[model samples]
Target: MANVTAKDAMQIHGRNPQHLVEKIIRTRIYDSRYWKEDCFALTAESLIDKAVELNYCGGIYGGNIKPTPFMCLLLKMLQIQPDKEIIVEFIKNEDYKYIRLLGSLYLRLTASSQDCYKYLEPLYDDFRCIRVKNRSGSLVRGHVDEFIDDLLHEDRVCDVILPRVQKRYILEETGEIQPRVSAIDDLLEDDEDTEKESDDELATSTRDQ
Candidate 1:
């Protein structure tokens, strides 16, 4: 019963939301001790405590294929199908990086292509460093923005196959979403302005001479 998705839960991506995680991975999560103990009877509201306690982000690890707390909570979120507003608040959370990551992953798995881009793209600016446990069970260094990029472009992340989403260019072409204006564009514009100023100064000096 613990592994079953909530009875009234709506379908996500045209199937059970938990199906977003592969069955094999989901089985391993069910067998995990964390799921048996910490995640027992967790409601959408109570899940916040577990999310806050997460120390790192990762999928399965080690020769035994152990599930990380991050993955455990991910499946639980799928099982419960928490309210979109609650998940949005999680995405907006600044206090806990893992909480933000949790929400971002949930959105990626369930939301439409446009909604995914709308929400996850902004997180590219979230540069906070996060530790990710690799398949070998060793903790590795990474940043939040790097993870977000993987979610946007990579086919798979943290051992889960992400649903295909439209490329930003495709969305822009269809006019479903506006063209992205990046921070780097602003920096390049500033550089051009500086160069123009330098050229004008050099020209005035030459004329005076």
Candidate 2:
């Protein structure tokens, strides 16, 4: 294993020398896995690479596991361009949940194709919200105005539209929701009922028992 200092590790990965050294020192103190000099260096390099990739796409590193909304916006911006093959590749990866988040943002920010909008309508209904500011802080506008205006001739969309869309999608995806099965209490009640019925029948059969 190569003996690596925090400064050497950051230099090797072309990261911010000062920040990387600070991060390595912090991780060495808190994260037991980074206590080893070689392991710490390798982890730092990986973090730097991941951070660079995210920055290129417009994301901010949120600890080791997640990226922020700014990153999603960046990815959306990249997707609008004609030549970014790597961005396309990243969007195609299913494991990249951020890609879906970016797509949602793109749809909202840009006028997407009608076909794309229709395809995403259900998901949008599920995830998106409209807010209006009045004298009070904020209020949900819902999709009532748009759906009614577009689908019907109404001034606002129906309140039921989103719920209906979500219900349809759930039905299509998971079949119909089955009735919940009895738990122990219900089962015990059923058993007691059966016993009562049996006792009644025995009383009827035996005249003087």
Q: Model 1, residue 105: displacement in angstroms? A: 0.7
The Cα RMSD of model 2 versus the native structure comes to: 19.0
Clashing pairs in 2: 58-71, 59-71, 144-157, 145-156, 145-157, 148-157
Per-residue C-alpha lDDT of model 2 across residues 5-58, encoded as one tens digit per residue: 333222212433222223433333334332232123334223223433331122
Q: What is the C-alpha lDDT of each candidate?
A: 0.93, 0.33
Which candidate leads in lDDT?
Answer: 1
lDDT for each residue of candidate 1 in 99-206, tens digit (9 for 90 to 100):
999999999999999999899888888899999999999999999999999999999889999999987889999999997777678899999999999999999999
Q: Which stretches of candidate 2 lie over 4 Å from their true place?
A: 1-92, 122-209
Error of 2 at 167 (Å): 19
**What TM-score would every model get versus the actual structure?**
0.96, 0.23
Question: How many Å off is the CA of 191 in candidate 1?
Answer: 2.1
Residue pairs that clash (backbone atoms under 3 angstroms), model 1: none
